[model samples]
Target: MHRVIAKLAGLTLLMLSALPSRAEEARQFRLSVPAEVAESGLMDYLLPRFALKTSRRAELVGGGAADAVISADPQAGTAVMARAGTVYALRLTGENAAARRFADWLSSDVGQRTIAAFEPEQGAPFAAARQQQAGPAPALDGDPALGREVALRHCARCHRTHDDDRSSGIGSTPSFPALRALPDWADRFTAFYVLNPHPAFLRVEGISPPFDPTRPPAIIPVELTLEEAEALMAYAASVAPADLGAEIVHQ
Candidate 1:
C-alpha cells in the first residue's frame, strides 16, 4: 500500500510540473526577423513597443543576423507601427483566427498609418510596392539560361556570380554552384532586399557611386517581365541544396 501511495504522489507531482510547461507553450508566440534588419538594430526599437502594447512577456533571441521574439501570454489586442512599410499588429499569434483577421485589416489602412508615422519621407511608390506580395512567381519561358542571365545582370552587382572568390569562394561569384542552392539564398536575399536596399553595397570596394543613405531606394528595375522573374525563380528553385531548399519554402 505504501509503494502504491508513493507512486500516486509521484504521478501527481509530475502532472503538476507539466501544467506550467504546457501553459507556457500554449501562450508562446515567436516572431522571426531576417539577419540584415537585426544587424541594423531595428528590433531594439520595435520589440519593446510591441511588448508594451500587447502586455506580453517578451524575450529577444538569436544574435547573428536573424532576430526573433518569443512572446509569452500575448494579450488579444491590435496595435500598429510603421517603418520601411506599415506593420499592423506587432504581435501576430499564428493560432488565433481573430489575430489573422485583424492583420488583414491593418494591412490596409492601419499599415498605411503606421508607415506614415515612422518614415514620412518615403515616396508613395515605394510604400505601395512594399505592401504588395513580393514572393517568387510562375516562370516565363522555363529556360534556365534566361534565368541565369537575369540573375547575372540584376543580382551580380552585389552578389558573386562565378564559383571563384574570397567572399563566397575562389570562383564562387554569387551565381549557382547548383540550382538547388537558390531557394534559401533567394529567401534571404529577398527578405533583406525587400526590407531595405543596402546603400553601402552600391559601390564595390575600390569602385565608385559613393554610399548615400539619403538617396531613394534602388529598385532592381526588372529587366525581365513578371513572367521572366517567375522563370528565373523556378530555375533557382530547381538547384539549391536540400536543407536550404526547405528553409526557402519555410521563409
Candidate 2:
C-alpha cells in the first residue's frame, strides 16, 4: 500500500513538471534581441507579419532564458543579418521549432524586405549582410567552358548568359554580363542561395537548411549541389562586363 502511494506521488510530480513544458509549447518561441532593436519598434512591425505568415508566435524574453538571441557578438554565433552597419548573429541556445522558424524568417525574403523597409527614427534601415568571407575573393578555379554550360542550364532561363542567347531570359531580370559589371557581383552570386526567391525554391543538397512545411514553394522547386552553384559562379565571372561608357557623338 505504501509503494502504491509513493508511485502515485511520483506520477503526480511528473505530471506537474510536464505542465510548464506544455505551456511553453503553446507559447511557441522565446527570442532575445538587443534593447535598441526592441526600442526601435522593429519587433512590433515584424512579429505580427511573421505570425500571419508562419502561424507561429514568438515572445520576447530576457537573454538568460531566451531560446535565441540576436547579438552583435560574432562569438555568440553565426552572423545572419546586418542593421545600420552593425552585423547581428543568431545565437541559438535551445531547440524549438518555432525558434528555428523565426530564424529562417529573419533570413528569408520577406524578413529581409521587412527589415530593410523599416525606417527607424534617425536610423538607417537594416540590410542583408553578405556571407562571411576571409580576405580578397580567390581566383576562379573552374573551367570557363564548364562554367558556361552550367550557367546556360541553370541561369540562362532568366538571365542572358551569352550574346548569342539574347532571345532568351526575362526582360525584367538583369543579364549575366550586366550583373557581372557590378563590383559586388561575386558576393551577390555567392550568397544567392540564401536570398529571396532562391530560398523559396532552391535547395542546395546538404548545404541549405530544409524548407519549412508551413511555407512551401509556390512554383516548382529547384535543387543544386554546392559544386553546381560554384560552377555557376565561375561562369558568371567569365562573362565580360558590359562597358557602360562614353556617350556617342554625332559630327
Candidate 3:
C-alpha cells in the first residue's frame, strides 16, 4: 500500500513539472534577433508581413533566443550597410515548418517588393522567379573551351587549369583537374562565388584593398555573368580528373 501511494505521488510531481514545458511548446513559433534589431522597430515592420505570408503569428525574442537571426553584416560598414541575407534557425522537428514558410515568403516576389519599399536605397525591389519543380536534375550545357578561357583569366591565379600549365596556384588551392575529379564537382560552379575558394581568395566584398598603382591586384574577385558561369561549369565537366596518387596502404 505504501509503495503504491509513493508511486502515485511521484507521478503527480512529474506531471506538475511538465506543465511549464508544455506551455512553452504551445506558444512556440518564436524568432530570435539581436536586442538592437528587436528594439529598433525592424521586427515591427517585418513581423506583420511575416504573419500575413505564413498565416501564423510569431513573437520576437531579444537577447538572441530566436528561431531566426536578423543582424547586420559584420564586414559591412555603417555608410552602406550591406544586406547579408537571412539566416534561418535549424530545428529538425516538424513544428518548425512555419519558420520555413516564413523564409520562403521573404524570398518571394511579394516579400521582395515590400522589403525594397521598406528601404528604398538598400532594398532594391525584388521580383521572385518562378519556383522550379522538384524532379530529375537537368543537364548542364555550355561551351567548355570558353569556360576554360574564363577560368584561365580569373581562376588561374590560384587554381591550375590544365595539364601542361606549369605555374601551380596557391598552396591550398586544388588544380581544376583535381576539383573536376570529385562527384560533386557540379556544385562548385553552381554558386561558385559564394562558396569556398572564391569566398576566401577572391570576392572578399566591401572595401577594396589598397594596392600599388603600377601593378594590378594579384587576385581580384571573379564576378561571372550567367553565360560565363555556365561555360565554366561545362569546362569543369570536360576536364579529366586529377590522379590523387597511390591508394593508402592500411596497416
Q: Give the candidate number with the greatest TM-score.
A: 2
Whole-model lDDT per candidate? 0.40, 0.70, 0.53
Name the TM-score of candidate 2. Answer: 0.52
The model with the greater lDDT, 1 or 2, is 2
Better of 1 and 2 by TM-score: 2
- Candidates in order, TM-scores: namely 0.33, 0.52, 0.41
- Residue-level lDDT of model 1, residues 1-251, one tens digit each, is 99999999999999897775644543333454444434545455444544454433334445232122212112222323212322223345356433343344334554343333343222221121122221332322467677667666765665544444235322433345432354335543322222334322322222123433564446543334554455555555544453333333553
Please give the lDDT score at residue 97 for candidate 2.
Answer: 76
- By summed lDDT, which 10 consecutive residues of candidate 1 come out lowest? 121-130
Residue pairs in collision within model 2: none
Off by over 4 Å in 1: 1-47, 51-129, 133-136, 139-141, 164-215, 238-251
Residue-level lDDT for 128 in candidate 3: 18
Stretches of candidate 3 off by over 4 Å are 1-139, 199-219
The sequence of per-residue lDDT tens digits that candidate 3 reaches over residues 1-251 is: 99999999999999998777644443346666555445545557767877765566676665345554444333221111112222222222235656556555555656544543453223221111122111122235689889889889987878888777877577688888887775557655444543322433333223212222553435654555556666877888888888878768999
Descending-lDDT candidate ranking: 2, 3, 1
Q: What overall lDDT, based on C-alpha atoms, would model 1 receive against the true structure?
A: 0.40
Models sorted by TM-score, best on top:
2, 3, 1
